[model samples]
Target chain A: MDRILYGDNQFFAVNHISDAKSMEQSMKFKENDAIIATLDQAIEAGIDTFMCTTHDRIAFVCDAVRSNPEKYKDFKIYPCMPYAHKYANAVTELGIQGTIKQYVPGNFFGSMFKGGKALVSKDYLAIMELLVDAEMKMFEGVKTPVVFLQNVITDLLLGLGMDEILKGFHDYVREKYDVEPGFITMNLPKLAETLEGLGIENPIICASINSANFRMSGGKELYEETLRTKKIRVIAMQVLGGGAIPPKEALGYVCGLPNIESILFGASSKRNIDNTVSTIHEFDSK
Target chain B: MLRVALVGAGKMGLSHLSILGAHPNVEVVGVCDTSLIVMGALKKYTKFPCYKKFTKMLDQEKPDAVFVAVPTKLHYEMIKELLDRKIHVFAEKPFCLNPEQGSELARLAEEHNLVNQVGYHNKFIGTFKEVKRIIESGALGEIYHFTGEAYGPVVTKKKDSTWRSNPADGGGCLMDYASHVIDLLNHLISPVASAEGTLLKSIYSQHVDDAVYSLLKLESGETGVLSVNWSDDTYRKMSTSVSITGTEGKIISDASELKVFVKKEGALDGYTKGWNVKYVTQLTDQVDFYLRGEEYSAQIDYFVNAALKKGPNDINTFKSAARTDNAIALIKNNSKTKA
Candidate 1:
């Protein structure tokens, strides 16, 4: 993960605080051009890493990057898998089989047989691999050094005690795609403990770490303690608590934390991107 | 005896379970479902070990064959792993959601030399089997046109919440109902070479089609029409019928009976063919135990026996199912372009 990774919440209508803002953002980014322009703005401001979900439209963004490889040579993407809404909508539109056909790359019949056999044999890890492949399909030939499991599935698997799958994903990504695997979760402390128990030392975890503790699960104190002690690379997200906290104060609070390797934020305009980047630089210098 | 297990405890899963469990040559090893409620219900019918996680079941039971009736979305990966494990699989139709997946699975099954079958139970229906026999015999010489109709009351109202109403889950009348018609058409006539004049209408579901109509041209040069509506509430129950017209005669067949008419004698077996009706009861095989439809059991039995190398591996193989998938892809593409 980069020191300042651009987030995709603004590209998709994902607002933790307001439905109105989410709807507004959804309308604004309805066109791929708008998303591309914003991404270009982020790149112009020296933010090279674009951490994003595998939304259907992200395929267009991946194409944009691939088309002008020279311009985005230093750029990178951290793809998150099982974009729940995408799969849900695809299921509603294409049906499961059709959804797999549309999303999963490779020969259709071969993939279908693969999918069918995985399901029958209860080889869910293989299914997860298929999904990961499906999500990463668009990023072929693009620079993607890290792949993150979205918190939606990460937390669900956590709750389900599916540690094997979590570890399996890490191993698969490293062995097959040759990328570092990252996990986003609401409960950082528990995740750290879980990863360490699985012998995954110094795991990279992205979670909410802020002054107000707005969306930070297990409270701010616990996250602080884990950051101070755990052998993990922490990526601070939602530092502004969905814009409840001021930017400078939020950046100051998170930047002052120990072992904070990255800060991920989303902004729709160049001005916001510029200000956030400058603020982080100022804090880093101090 | 062949050891078998089942994943998915839904309607189809239970159907497969009942037949597999009762079969004389099968030993039901395990049943797995994500839902405890579903697995709990399954426990009443069989004392086999139940599991919420499929991998656990597979690891513990290690069955020689597995029957999968999970959502269509889950077919590809599941089928792939089963093939890798060398476990013969009997999957529910449509074999896959798309042509690519269907073809891939077909290829893998052939490569692995595995006995793979899709749940196109209509093929096993007595009337349908007789219809296929008549067509293969060329009783209806120079077949020129055919029509297929399937109607039911599965989605008469808004069904936005269920997987069947969702396209990703392989929901909608087109994939669910029209697929059967397409398979039957492929069996009786020939693989659909081109499909046109498609109408995919949604009466109750916003995502998937509730009614589907299409014009098809088979590779055998036979023209056909398919009309299927899951939203139609007037039908007393689900009804699917096919009528084929040829140079010498015509035949109309449904689940219950097959009616044939011939202009010349000796056109079909044991029939002068002025107008003859053969009820399903008269044509069906005598079975010791049955549920839902004998065709369902027949398909399962065929797969198991095929897996045991006692029968020919010719029961709706993935290759055959891929043809239906191709027809579906064509219909869907045509409908989208027109829309």
Candidate 2:
């Protein structure tokens, strides 16, 4: 994992801190070319991995990366799966049956699985595979070395105690895509314990890690304790506490922590990207 | 542990189940749904008992509280059954097909001295809660006009048959999407006393309107515009927000963030005049189990805690949500008359 990873929240108008800033980002990155230009700047700023959600626009990004293979040779994308809206919108337009038929295909539609509830764990695993395939369709030719399960599903599975589904994702991604399966969640301590329980060792987990507890469930102390003790590759995001912390203070606190393999952040500008990269470098050097 | 049973194991049902399943004070005893396959999976996966019928699940489990996440139409009967059983209940939003049903359910719950709530999850959003606190604090004095909006890509295409395509099933931008915004306006600003100049436009779904626009008059003489559309594909997900203007300041807020511009800097704590902004992460208190957002679990937490109380419920209770339902009916009637 790269010590520094760039993110796509800014491209999609997802500023956890400010709506005004989000709108500004939306206007600035309204075009696919604009998005590509920002990525180029991230590359110049020395960020090789782009951690992004599978928003429909990410397809255009994938196409752009594919067309200019030489320019993006060293670049990689960490795809967060289920792109929930894809299924949400589909279910909105076509309901459950139609969504499964359109997305799941094959046995899911043809078998005695007409009743959505009738489909058992076997079908669920198949559906998970198919949906993962569908979500990964956007990254066809790009290099996605680590695929992530979005926190929504990760936390849901965690809450439901669906350990097998978590492992199912781990196994499917490792076996099928030949990539490491990562899980992003708000509750790092709980997930760490759960993964430990599942016998899934040293998992890759990206969560909110900052001086403030922020989105980290349990609390900041627990996250720090987990980081110190857990066997996991931790990609720290929301280190700024949704911009609550100053850049220097945020980076300083996170950089001082152990086992933080990468720090993920999103920026829609060259200046901000460069500043963030330089700040992280300064803290790491210290 | 508070014994809890769930009805309607659809998306929202399952979501609530997961969070409640993990709640420290809660034990999910049974889950009921019409979907055999959903039941089959629940039986196979989780330790909770699964049933196809709601009555049987409630009768067998004898839960202290029942979470009814069924469609809007099913809300009335199922919730009434729970209230009749003297069980504290939580139902999903856009409470019922009409205000009449909502009021009846509210009356039943009140008469039985039960804690009841509707899942207007936005009320638990810290940013929006801050908006309410700011407005009520008179930081934004003499609030005049506002606009409530929600636009998403839910019904971008013309559909064959779905819950979203049927008005009876609480399909439509107004019911499914706009209700969240309407409820926010009701709770944050004022209960909409009436509505006028309504325009329910169908951009995609033939059976139901995909967009709802209208002028709403709140009980406190505050006025606002309701603009909602589910056919807008620009947003990756449902985006709901409110922009309220007052003589002293103006506040614009969504699920993720809140922005306020005030004439005086010292008007509110943690907020400077001129301009101040806050995020969900900063404002929201952390929950033990967070699903999509803390608001989802927080809403359920509120309901579950309120369930243990003896008297009437508070915070998105049946009575409070009935106001939103009444507002929805006003908008619907106004739109129909003009159309």
Best-fitting candidate, measured by TM-score? 2
Put down candidate 1 lDDT per residue, A1-286, tens digits, no spaces: 6799999998787664443466588789889999999999999999999999887788998899989989999999999886866554455444545566666656644643554432422335566688788778889989899899988666545643457778988999999998899999866877888899999979889987888764455567778999999999999998887776789999999989999999999988789999999999999999
- What is the per-residue lDDT of model 2 for residues A1-286, given as tens digits with 9 covering 90 to 100? 9999999989888877665677687788899989988899999999999999998889988998899889889989999987776776676566566677788745656756544336668878887899899889879989999999999889888887778889999999999999999999988988999999999989999999988677877777788899999899999999888777888999999999999999999877789899999999998998
The DockQ score of candidate 2 comes to 0.57
Q: What lDDT does each candidate get?
A: 0.81, 0.86
| Cand. 2 TM to true fold | 0.94
Q: Number of the top candidate by lDDT? A: 2
Cα-based lDDT at residue A23, candidate 2: 68
User: In terms of docking quality, how is candidate 2 classified?
Assistant: medium
Ten contiguous residues with the weakest lDDT in model 2 chain A? A108-117
Cα distance off (Å), candidate 1, residue A47 = 88
